[model samples]
Each structure stands twice: as structure tokens, then as C-alpha cells.
Target: MTFTQLLRKENDDIFQAIFNHPFVDGIGKGNVPDKAIAHYIKADFEYLNAFMRIYGTAISKSAKREDIQFFNEQIRFVLNSEIHPHHNFCDHIGVGYEELQGYALPPTADHYMKHMMYHAHMGGLGETISALLPCPWTYWEIGQELMTKYEPSADHPFYQWISFYADESTGEITEEMRNRLDNIAEEASVEEQKHIKEAFRKSCQLELSFWEMAYTCEKWPGKEKVNS
Candidate 1:
């Protein structure tokens, strides 16, 4: 089995929990509170920004020219395609860029982004790639399963978001990235492979935290809520 496939199989419980999470199920039915969805989108925007930087750092750390090109293309997709339409969606739902940008990241958000960035900045190419793999792969897996259950309408609030992952094209991209990760694994030393797998597992756990965070609209610790 491919490393990613093994990771998925061994971590099936986490994936199931994430896929079954109310945050995801709600999106599938288009019934999540706008407040919750808005919070997720805002946090996701910041996460994507961090992803771009982490991806760029991966490109710099790569020894393979093809991997560099792949990173460049993926980064372009994030900037050119993934993010702008998201901004439009947020605009439609009353999430302003300034509001999103100025808001502090939730604890889960802060921890997850740091997790990816650590591998990107401090580890080798294998660690970087593995650290980054879970998000897109898990999203694609979720989208495919959700699409089987729900056909989104054009006016559906999250239609574009769902489509972004459900697109036939995205599966190819996810598979290609996974293959690259496997290749990186094949080339890695035993110690590096150990670190890479640990990174992948940690990212998967963080992904679950992300969904729960959105579900609860979790925020960092702060002043106690004032009773109205």
C-alpha cells in the first residue's frame, strides 16, 4: 500500500470522525449556521495564506526540479483560483477581508498552521510534503463522499466550496501529490521516514481539531464572556 493509503487506513477512525463531524455534515446539508460557516471561512483564509508560505518554503527545500514546479503550480492555484472565489463567497456571507484578516486565529488554527510551518522550515522535503498532505487529501475524500449524498445547487451557499474539492480535476491533483509524497518517502532515510509519518499523523489530528473548532466556533482563551 502507498504510504498515504496506509496512513488513511490506520487512521480510519479519525477520518470517519472528521467526515461525520457536524461541521462537515452541516455543510453537506447547507444547514450550518451562517455564523459558524463564517468563522470557519475566516479561519480557513488565514490557514491558506499560511499554506502558501509553507508551500513556498517547501519549494525552496526541494531537491527535485519537478517538485519545485509542482509546488509553484499548487501555490498559483491557491492564490489565483482557491482564494479569490472564496473571498467572493465570504463577501456573499458578510465576511469582510479586513474582518477576517484582523481576527485572531483560534487555538486550533494557530497550532495547526505552526505544525505545518515547522516541518516546512525545519525539516527536509519529505517532512514538508507529508506535513502538507492531509488537508487536501482529506478534503478531497470528504468532498467525494459528500457529493455522493448531496448535489449542490448553484445558489447553495457552499456550492463553490464544495465544487472546489469535488471537481474531477482535484482528485488528480491530490493523487499526484500523494504519489510525490510516496516517492519522497522512498528516498528518505529511516529517521526521515519516521519523522514524515509522525508529521502526517499529527496533521490528521489537527484536521479533526479544525472541524470541531468550526463546529464550536472555538476561540483562544480570553476575557470571560459578559452576560447581556
Candidate 2:
């Protein structure tokens, strides 16, 4: 099996939990609370900003022009294309896309962002790809699964969101990422491969936490102190 496939197999339980999570299920059924969906979109807006920076970090570490271009294309895709779903969600809820940019990163998002950033800064291309793969990979899987299960129509409440991730183009992009990681693994040292596995596993766990965070609109434990 491909290394990416093996990683998915190892983390199958987490993937299943994400699939069965109420927040994801609600998206499939089109019954998720507006508040919860809004929380998720806002936090994800922040997350995507950080994601772009991590890609930039990867570009800096890349030796090959093709690798640099690959990261650049992904950054452009995220900036220009991937966020269409966010806009669709915002329009559904009567919020401006720009407004989401002002939202704070919730605790789970903060941790997840830091995790990716840490790997991007501290590791080589393989580790960086490992840290980054789970977000798009899992989302693609979720979208594909939801589409199969619900066969949502265009009029479905979350159809745009669902279809965005489930698009054939999205699958292609994620497959490219998997291929890149596998190629990197072939050159990775034994210790580096272990680190790559850990990074992938941790990112999977964070992906799960992100869904639960959105489900509950998770917040800090106490009120913020006043500057006064």
C-alpha cells in the first residue's frame, strides 16, 4: 500500500469519528445550527490564513522548481478557489466574507495552526507535507462520503459546501498531495519517516478536534481580563 494509504488506515478510527461527528452529519442532513456553522466558518477562515503561511514555509524549504510551483498553485487555489464554500456559507447566513476575517481563532484552531506551523518551520519537505495533508485529505473524504450517502441536490442547504470538497478537482488535488508525500517518503530516513507518521497522525487528531470544536463552539475556560 502507498504510505498515504497506510496513514489513512492507521487513522481510520479518527476518520470514522469525524464522519460520524454530529457537526459533519448535520452538514450532510442540512440541519446544523446556524451558530455552529458560523463558528466553524469563522474559525476556518483564520485557519486557512495560517495554512497559506505554512505553504510559504514549505516553498522556502523546497529545492526543486516544481515543488515550489506546486506549493504556489496550492496557495493560489486556497486563496482563489477553496474559499468559495466559505463565501457560500456566509451568504446563506447573511454575513460578509470579509467579516469572517475578523474572527478570532478558537482554542482548537489555535492549537491546530500551531501544530502545522511548528512542523513547517522545524522540519523538511516530508514532515511539512505530512502536517498539511490531513486537512484537505480528510475534507475530500468527508465530502465524497457525504455526497454518496445523501446525493444532495443543488437546492440542498449545504450542497455548495458539500460539492466543493467532493469535486473531482478536489480529489485530484489531494491525490497529488498524497503522491508528493509518498515520493518524499521514499527518500526519507527511518527516523524522518517516523516523524512523518507522527505528524500525519497528530494532524488527523487535530482535524477531529476541529470538528468537535465547531460542534460545541468551543471557547476559553474563563472570561478575558480587562486591560483597565
Candidate 3:
């Protein structure tokens, strides 16, 4: 199996919970609580900043021009166009965009972001991609599947979230990202391949925890790292 496929299959249960999580299902039905979803958007908004930095780390670590180009493309989208609407989503939830940056990092989020940065700093191109894959890839799959299965109403509260990831271009970008990871994986030794797969599985599990964290509306504990 390809590393992606292997990772997904090994963690099928987590993927199932994530894809079918109440937070996800709630989006389709517009049944999610305002405060809970708001907390999620805030956490995700904070997470994206770190995610963008990790992509930069990947670009610097990569020797391949195409890989660099791909990471750059993601970096541009995240900074320029990708997050504007999400900030608006935060506003709708009653948190100002600027205020979100000051909130303490929820435990799961801090742990997950640290996990990603470590791999980006310590791992090679393939390993960085493995560490990064589960978030976008899982969202891409869920976005496509949920919109189709549930066909959320036009006025669905989370319509934009459904529309963005479910869009055709999003799928193309996701496929391109996967191809880049696979290309790098082809150059790795067996031991390195094992490392890459482990990273993929760990990230996938983190993705599940992220969803759970959001669904439960876990607030920032008294002692934890602040979002940067």
C-alpha cells in the first residue's frame, strides 16, 4: 500500500470517528452549538498560523524545486486568501479575529501543533509531508463525502466550510500535495519509509483528537502555552 493508504487503513477507526464526528455531522445539519463551533474556529484559526509556518519549514528543508513551489503555493493561499473568511466566521461566533490570537492554546491544539513543527524541523521532505497530510487530506475527504452524502441546505450555517473544501480545485490541490509526498517517499530507504509511515499515522490520530477537542468545547486550561 502507499503510505497514505496504509496510514488510513491502519487508523480506520479514528478516521471513521473524525469523518462521522458530531461536529462534522452537525455542520451538515446546522445543528452544532454556536459556542462550541466558535471555539473550534478560533482554535483552527490559531492552528493555521502554525500550519503555515510548518509549510515554510518544509519548503526550506526541501531540495526539490517542485516541492518548494508546492509549499509556497500553500503558504500563499493560507496567508492571502484562505483565512479571510475564517476570520469572518469567528466574528459571527462573537469572537473578534484579533482576540482569538490572544487565547491560550488548548492542550490538544498546542500538542498537535508542536507535533507538526517537530516533524517539519526534524524530518525530511517526505516526513514533513507525512506529518502534514492528515489534516488537509482528512478534511478534503470529509468535505467531499459530507457534501455529497448530506447535501447540506443552501442556507446551511457552515455552507462555506462545506463549499470550500468540496470545491473541485480543492480536490486538485489535495491530489497534487499527495503526489508530492509520494514522489519524495520513492527516494527514501526502508527505514526512512517506516519513519514516514509512523509520522502519517501519528498525525492522523492528532487529526481525530483535534475534532474531539472542538466537539467537546474544551477550554484552555489555566497553565498552557499561549498561541503565537
Candidate 4:
């Protein structure tokens, strides 16, 4: 099979796993506690910002000028659409506009950010997408699961967020990404295939930790501050 096919298979596997997760139900129903959701949203944006800084620095230092410029533009587009608008999540959860940034995130939170930096430094944009795709795509796939397993409505936050990113409303997926996956597949050796498989698996495993960490911090006992 081609690399594109294999890449799709890998994404499918991860999405299926996430869709079946009990936590996914909370996401679908928008049943997640507001404080927890707020914290997660803030943490996610901070993480993305840090990731871009690392990636931008690394590429500028080593990549050809044109390639660096192109990747920077793509990353800018992603951040502008995905991260900035997502900040309004705090307001949805009853927090003040400035309060979200002051919230202290879990210490282990940087693992994903650092890993992304390392990957971008080593592998550039295509590899960067390989590492990044699991999160958004997983959610999109889980939305499908939620739709299949439960009734849908306009008020449901699950449908709101999922549809925002995955459906025609947002147009998150791009033809460039499709071509990149196809090219990677066409060029990959057996060893590279193994590496890609492992990277996808590792990325998923990290994703699980990411969710679990947020859950733990919010649910932790005897905490004086709830939102931070």
C-alpha cells in the first residue's frame, strides 16, 4: 500500500481509539466541568504558542529562506484560526478575559510542546503535521462517533466545536496536506515507514496523557485555587 493509504490507516486507528474513550463522551456532550475546560483551553493555546516559537526559531536557523517563509505562513494561518479564536473558551466558562493566562498549568504539560519543537527542528513542516494531525483529526473523528451514538442538536457544544473545525464551515483539511502525505508515502523506505508508524503511535500515547493530565489537575483534591 502507498504511504497515503498507510497514513490514513494510522489516523483511523488513533481516531477510533479516541472515539471509544469514555472521556470523549464528556467532550461530545460538553459535559466537561467548566473550570476544567477553561484550564484546558488556556493550556492548549499556551502550548501552541510555545510550539510555534520553537518551530519558527529552528526553521529560520536551518531551513532555506523560501522554505522557512512558506512554513511560517502556514503556521501563522493555523494559529490565527485555531488558537486565537479558541481563547474565547475562558469567557464561555465564566472566567475573566485576563484570568486564563494567569492560571498555572500542570508541570508535565511541556512534554508535548517540547516534543513538537524537537520534531519541527529535525523534520520540518511535513513531519510537523504528522505530529500535529492527531489532535484535531481525532476530535473530528470522535464527533462522527458522537453523531452516530447520540442525537445531534444546534445547542450541543460537541457539534459546535467539532463542526467548527472538521466540516465545511471551517475547512481545516487542505489539499496540500493530502499531497504531502502521498509524497511521504511514495518516498518512504521500509525503515522510514516503521518510524512513521512509531511516531503516530507515540503521538497518540502522548495525546492520551495530555487529556489525562488535564483531568487529573482539575480533579485533584484539596486545591485552594480551582481555575488555575
The best candidate by TM-score is 2
In candidate 1 the C-alpha lDDT for residue 177 amounts to 80
Candidate 1: tens digits of C-alpha lDDT, residues 45-111? 8898899999899888878898889999999988787775466457666767567664567889999
125-210 per-residue lDDT for model 2 (tens digits): 89999999999999999999999999999999889999999999998888988999999998889999999999999999999999
- Model 1, residue 58: C-alpha shift (Å): 0.7
Candidate 3 Cα misplacement greater than 4 A, ranges: 84-88, 91-95, 220-228
How good is model 4 by TM-score? 0.74
Cα deviation at 178, candidate 4, in Å, is 3.9
Could you say which candidate leads in lDDT?
2
Error of 2 at 117 (Å): 0.9
**Which portions of model 2 miss their true places by more than 4 Å?**
225-228
Worst 10 residues of 4 by lDDT: 169-178
Judging by TM-score, tell me the better candidate of 1 and 4: 1
Q: Which order, best to worst by lDDT?
A: 2, 1, 3, 4
Backbone clash count, each prediction separately? 0, 0, 0, 1
lDDT of 1 at 227: 50
Winner by TM-score between candidate 2 and candidate 1: 2
lDDT of each: 0.83, 0.91, 0.79, 0.60
Q: 1-228 in candidate 3: lDDT tens per residue?
A: 775566668878877888788887877776777777777776888898899999999889878797789889998888876665576466457767666664556789999999988888877878888888888888878888789988877677677877787887777777787887777777889988898888888888889888788889886757655455
A best-first ranking of the candidates according to their TM-score comes to 2, 1, 3, 4
Model 1: what TM-score? 0.90
Model 4 accuracy (lDDT, Cα):
0.60
TM-score of 2: 0.96
